[model samples]
Target: MTDVPGFPPHTQLLAALARLGQATRMDAVRNAGPHNLSPLQADIVGLFRRGAAVLRQSDIVTALASTAPTISDAVRVLRRKGLVDATADLADARARLLVLTPAGEAEAERLTAFSDGLVEAVDTLPEQDLAAILRAGTRLMRELESRNLIPMSRMCPTCRFFVPDAHPGEVRSYHCDFVDAPFGAAELRVTCPDHEVRD
Candidate 1:
């Protein structure tokens, strides 16, 4: 059954995603306002707080799925604000690795706490439902990355937790050792926060 000008499943999904994105941006703006930081600057600081130690400018671009020029602009603004510092890479003199200043580190801690609190406040889903949603979202992201619509990820296929089926007769063709559960190609996660890199 269909109605004229009605949103299909895809349209509804896109609209939901867009609204979430806008809400997230507003949250960032509100949180960063007191520190005189933009959303991008806050994001960069958050990245470092999340264990990204000394990354190149290109790395930030890739992680944020943003353009080099946009990242450069943000980095410049951050440097000017004394929240970030850069030094030439020893191995590649032409390249620079970014690090957070002492002030930046303190701000990062505050921002991380604020972000965690905000997320906790809005998160109403049960654990099982949240896991299901995360799996589905990661699957969609993987599909997009496979189609070259998004950047490649540190995902299941490249993770130590992944175990490919060794026997064609197996009922489940793939497994996630971490979850101890069977997984299908379409259900494989592309951006699991718990992902561990394969040796």
Candidate 2:
């Protein structure tokens, strides 16, 4: 979409982001095309690939920020494709846990690297741009997630241990109570595996 000349700066920025998002989806579709997987199926597989345990249908729905029926249908398709298997959870006799077959795991591995080329392209950008992207991305994710517009992320800003600009003029500005240390933007985590969400 072309940017409107008279549009405000924020509007223009959002438009650019929307274009990037569309491009990302297009890339995902293209990458998964050879595997005969839709973008959603690929995403599901990727999620499972990252996880160590089986996931419930509801877990898939919540993680993808999708509806129950939608995830159910996708799971059915995946099962039909022989990519996923369902088993009863020991903890809950009625709950069915979804696990990937060997073929599914292989496909998941492929899907995991779909954006590696994009990451290398992004690495060619300036350090300042990279820092700005990390800050802005986490802020936007936090804002959207607060309104339940998207899935939750473990961002430093919303983490209980995070302290912004703890040292005003110091090179290492932000503070992490978890580690009891200050860090610069380069070290700021947009998606911290150890982050605990602030209550």
In the order shown, the candidates' Cα RMSDs to the true structure are 4.9, 4.0
- Tens-digit lDDT track for model 1 on 1-199? 8586877889999899899888788888878755688888888888786646698998888888899999999999889888899998998988899999998888888886556656785577765576567567767876887687876566777689988783356545788888888866546665566678788
Location of the lowest summed lDDT over 10 successive residues in candidate 2: 186-195
lDDT of each: 0.79, 0.83
**lDDT measured at residue 136 in model 2 versus the true structure, 0 to 100:** 81
Give the number of the best model, judged by TM-score.
2
| Candidate 2 global lDDT | 0.83
The residue-level lDDT of candidate 2 at 97 comes to: 95
The parts of candidate 2 lying over 4 Å away from their true place are 1-5, 91-94, 115-117, 159-183, 187-189, 192-196
Off by over 4 Å in 1: 1-5, 114-117, 153-158, 162-199
